[model samples]
Target: MKRRQTPSNGTMFLLLGFSDLSLAAQTSLFVFFLLSYLFAVIGNGLIMLVVTFSPRLNSPMYFFLTVLSFTEILSISSTAPKALQGFLKAGRTISLIGCATQFSVFIAAVNCESSILTVMAYDRYMAICQPLRYTSVMTVSVCWKLTMIAWIFAFGNAVIGFSVLFNLPFCESILIAHFFCDVLPVMSLACGNTFFLEVFQLIMSVTLIMSTFTLIICSYVRILTSIFLLPSAESRHKAFSTCGSHLVSVIIFFGSAMFVHFHLGNPLSPYNDRMVALSYCVIIPTINPLIYSLKNNEMKEAIWKLTLKIVALHM
Candidate 1:
């Protein structure tokens, strides 16, 4: 009898995206996701360019918003393209190395996004809770440093998370039940003991997710206290107007992420998992720009100006 080859680094993972459906259904799904991708890119791209060039948006809050827009683009781009390609391509395969790379990028984006959101909450907290010291507290250098730290921290986390799987052997059946590469899905393929890895991943997830959430919650608690202490109704209304968008965005991202991560390993609900993952990884990022823009006066004005500039150039 011939000795069977053990799957190693060269193994390929079939991304089994979207259930096997009719051609029409698949094509429709592709079109929907493609449009969503374009919308998110354009929305976030315009936000970045406007914030970079618009003098009116020179405040620390907008600076953080710009960081958020860019991060949103990066986060969604990591997973969406490959998932969209799954509809058109057969098997939708990626090499073990490629899968690992994708997971790292996706996870880094997620972590960076969470960090930025936390920082943004702090920005709002400062602006509202400490108006006199806002500029001094949120200096240009400080903002830049925070942004860099978030990026560095996220990437470092990804590196450490994947290091454990560096030499782990994969099973012969490499079919990933969901779209794109995710931490749990990728780790599930390993033939060796992954209990500690899963535990570590869960701990990290809870730590970051809950910690950031607690920070945001604490900031908001202070913010609400500060807002209510204001003598004038107009001031309280203004405070709400300023902070409402970020709060909505926070709920959206956190809600989706918590659902997906916590609800993993339900043997009876693969399709439910797929749907939730699709919405979380694809839909949420796309809608986030719209959420921020819809309520933001500054962003709306900037987008309008950018749109006119484009039309004028064409003419």
Candidate 2:
């Protein structure tokens, strides 16, 4: 395929505006992102470890949770370290291929997470709405099949998106204004009319966001109706509590993603794009495991036990 070349003016010396910031602000941002990255890794890592070791957590829920943690780690790693390096260095120039690879992996991880969350919502629905049939419906074989499908779909989407994108001709100017090489930022650098790619991305974004979110909403609606019909307050509370963490995580992840990809204006400004990108790419992943672990008793207990074992070993 012939490469689409971007105009010369679009390509310029890209500087991560932070280099112009006061030393204090630079130091503050660096420290903030550094700590955020550390917590993200540790928090997600702990989730994976806990899910792996705890027999009580060997169900479909924790299985999906483990996959989520792994995806979160991959997603954050794609962008945060490079952004941190840019803050420390005088110049942050990512090679063309490197930028494309980063975006591809990041997109794949995000898509995988979306599908996994949808599957988890379905799991919750079965557990609550059809308690007796839950096991049969969400059998071990079914769970693995769903996970595999999610991964394959995500991989295909990422490959197609990146293949289309990398084929575009980039000018000599290689500076990406944002912390990462997101679709829009990279597209803006292309000289040709990226209308088709933009349209395709919008369609994909709407389909993924709306379809998954709709499934989740339907699941929760059924759950809520069932909860209300029950006479016992405790049962209702237990059911709602079980889903609350997942609900919040879904809102943050999908909300931020939809805002950035669907609602953001075309010819978006660098500042606006970067701010929105940070919410999905950096903020959500950092907070998700914390939210899940804190709200989930099983996960909390598993973490506690693991901590104790590690401490005992040290002693």
Candidate 3:
């Protein structure tokens, strides 16, 4: 609200998303991405079904995982469909209102993932550190509350971010650099002074992401310390195994998010940024179930049996 520029209310914005690619490349990418999206959907869908039915998975950890799968699905869906549409058509275009809405949903979904991962870290911390009190501490009611807070907080953050973006007067050239309506690229189009909003976004991204990652690192550090303190080597190994899947997820998500957010300006190229965004937003969620299947024996056993049951039913 500081500087003066005209607001392009309801003006259409064109996204320069993959339009530079050759016809053959675009067709090839479309086929590949279609398969990947289907796999991610089916995988996450299976997790939701199995967890819902398996009473043994009624524990806090699995409950949190169900919520995560749901979030990952929502997150991937937020941008993938629209991008696919972009590939199919001449160019990706959206009304200002549509851009704002997409921005809000994408931002909220990503934040939800960050919140859920942090909550999962706490679950692991309690399970390993205070095994006796883990149940009492993370009750059914408490899990619901924690999850609600994550969702609510995420949307709220997105709302605030949207407000900042919407308040700014935009440039005449309404072409967005990225595939979808990402905040930074959209913000970069603003004319006049946008220093405040830009700084606000950077600060928010740094603070929230760094703090959550710090908490996770600290949690794992304590868990590892406790594991090593165990009398038996087998017991220590068992403890480490329990957290392996979540730790790997943390590393991938946090590392990707950090690189994308902080490497925004001079250090990053737009081309590399697109690839990174594709990885975390599309590829990571798609492979999330794969990570669980390979790393966590419990989820592997359950998903494998569930897959067999479904196949047999079809037979």
Candidate 4:
């Protein structure tokens, strides 16, 4: 397939998303993505609402969980719509500005998710390892400050990265191989040298991902050590259980994120990349409410209470 070289000022870029696939496959993906997108939005939105209103959930952990749910909503919203459109139609076109905006929002959301997860890990560490000082260390004001920092860092990185990436001359081709304006796919379309941009992206990816991952790992290590030191096995199990949901979330998110960002030369194929991206963007957000809520007794209890209250009101 040949593409005509378009000027950098080209307003629209064709997203060649799954056009090569059979109609049946595309239609199947359309249905699947539509359902997944809806589930992700509603599930994450519900988690946020429950955590915000439930008096029993008024803790630093739940506060951070609310932030995480909000981030997941943003993450799914950024890519799932474009992806669904591409699956529904052969070639979906997105304006350059629109593409840039999507990329910025998605990147910010990803960054924020990682940062918030790290904060949650720290909260767990404080609770488990320093139980007496947990309240003092993770107070409401401090939690708000930390959450604000995450938001500021995410948006700052997104704005800087977007400005650099979009300024590049994309005279080679306008057809983004993937559904969304991902960094690599758009970078591949650049006509001139992208060495600086590539390095910048690498730096950003490594810094945001690995830094948060390391912090989480360190927090978990301390938490585990503290759990082991507990006198009774029951207490140890109880302490470990509290961190279980968060640990699972971290693993799922970072596993896919690392695979996508850390690899050279498309880790398998373009389709595989899309699948992995889909997992983190759509699957993760959709399943996060389940991971945090189903595995968590408090979350389940809160949901049950909230549901009953709604039922009574409706009755």
Q: Alpha-carbon error at 43 in model 1, in Å?
A: 0.7
lDDT of 3 at 238: 88
User: For residues 63-167, could you state the per-residue lDDT of candidate 3 as single tens digits?
Assistant: 988898998888778787778888856648888888888889889988988999999999999999999999899999999999999999999999999988877
Off by over 4 Å in 4: 1-10, 265-267
Q: How well does candidate 3 score on lDDT at residue 113? A: 88
Off by over 4 Å in 2: 1-17
Ranking 2 against 3 by TM-score, winner: 3
TM-scores, all candidates, are: 0.93, 0.92, 0.93, 0.94
lDDT of 1 by residue, 112-217 (tens): 9999999999999999999999989999999999999999999999898777654566666687887888877776777767787777777788788999999999
Residue lDDT tens for model 4, 1-315: 334354444478888877888889888888888998899898889898888779999999999999999999999899988887876564498988889989999999989999999999999999998999988889899999999999999999999988888877666467788889998888888876777778778877888889899999999989899899999999998998899999999999999988887874334587877777788878999999889988788999999999999999999
Q: Tell me the TM-score of model 1.
A: 0.93
Per-candidate alpha-carbon RMSD to the true structure? 2.3, 3.3, 2.4, 2.3
Q: List, residue by residue over 75-177, the lDDT tens digit for candidate 2.
A: 9999888889888575477666677678889999999999999998999989988999988888889988999999999999999998888777765545667
lDDT of each: 0.83, 0.83, 0.84, 0.87
Pairs of residues clashing in candidate 1: none
**Stretches of candidate 1 exceeding 4 Å from the true structure:** 1-9, 265-268
Among these predictions, the greatest TM-score belongs to 4
